[model samples]
Target: MGTIRKGANGGFSGKAGSVIGASWKSIDYIRGLSKKSNKPATEEQLIQQARFYTIAKFIMPIAPFVQVGFSQINANTMTPTNAALQANIKTAVVGTYPNFVLDYAKVQISQGSLQPGGTVKAEVATGMLMISWTNKAIAIQNGQLDDLVYILLYHPELDEFLTAPEPPTRGLGTVDIELPEHFLGGKGQLWLFFADRKNKRISRTNYLGELDLV
Candidate 1:
């Protein structure tokens, strides 16, 4: 411990030699003392961070599903699975259209087994919607792994329907869709289900829930 002193702004500060320091912010914060970097985060870094944050929010709910997917595909570890998932999300966001693609071959090892059970949650914010689910597949012994996901969105007021394909994730799965602000007051229905590697529907469709998009 170097020294502790009261600040003019009614705060407290502490110094530990010339290497670390502490400050009060309602609570004490201790951290390495160093000169702040003059360079700010680059545009590319900011973009990457934004993309990662958005993907994290989108995938957090389905993290369990992703883990299970990795396990079923014999990728029973975190390092590679996380790297691949991050790369996939980056590819999706960088493309003209934002949608996830599954690596079926990697996950198709245990095909034709039993279907996994899980829960899903859907939420809408401004111009975006997120769907996240848990990986209940792990609970099943020798269960059939879902190779793909089919998402169906229907707007009753506009009589419009949108369908998209999503990759199957382990531990949990999540997908983000872009919607117009006009859809705010509109009521809609969302459905999800598992499909085979050949793009064939396997499990019964699950009605995730209805959304007001407000």
Candidate 2:
């Protein structure tokens, strides 16, 4: 852009002839309009775009969880969602470009020093879903009793997700969550993890297995 002194016509604020003019910091400037490119994509570029499209389609819906999951990764240049996608695309995605498939079992939501509880169980009681782990006293002794539980249920077929409100602590051993009306006739997958009371620590996510929600 070239700076210009105000003329008899004053400074222009929009397009005039082949150039555009605007004022910044009380100084007037004029720059030529940029040209648009209509270049066509090459075969290789299309394939790469397909792979990115496949991963992005799945990741966008659960981006909120992805941010928390990849918060600890040491990548300063990219967002947490991008970090999670890069990490998962290598191992969790299967098949070729046009048919890329994401393996839910291989997906890692949260990674941290905290360890997961053993022998997790999922059961449907009336309209409530109950999740439990073994030996709550063990966690209390280790100073993780107050770690809050976070549960996520995803219905792949419906492309929907459900989360618990005001989850209980790890010391409770088992938590009962009310199932939504939409989840009554449908089935979905379950995953759970523990976040410390202060929310500074997160345990590796545990896949609590798929359930026939009722």
Off by over 4 Å in 1: 1-117, 139-146, 165-172
Q: Which candidate number maximizes lDDT?
A: 2
lDDT of candidate 2 over 1-214, digit per residue (tens):
4334466567767777789988764666788899886998887887777777766777778887766766666545567788777877666677776777767777766667766666788888678988888555564435477777778888877888887788677778888888877778777788877777765677788887778877
lDDT for position 67 in model 2: 69
**Lowest lDDT 10-residue stretch of candidate 1:** 103-112
Q: lDDT of candidate 1 vs native?
A: 0.52
* Tens digits of per-residue lDDT for model 1, 116-166: 346778888876778876655554522344456656666757756555444
Off by over 4 Å in 2: 1-39, 42-44, 135-143
lDDT of each: 0.52, 0.74
Q: How close is candidate 2 to the true structure, as a TM-score?
A: 0.72
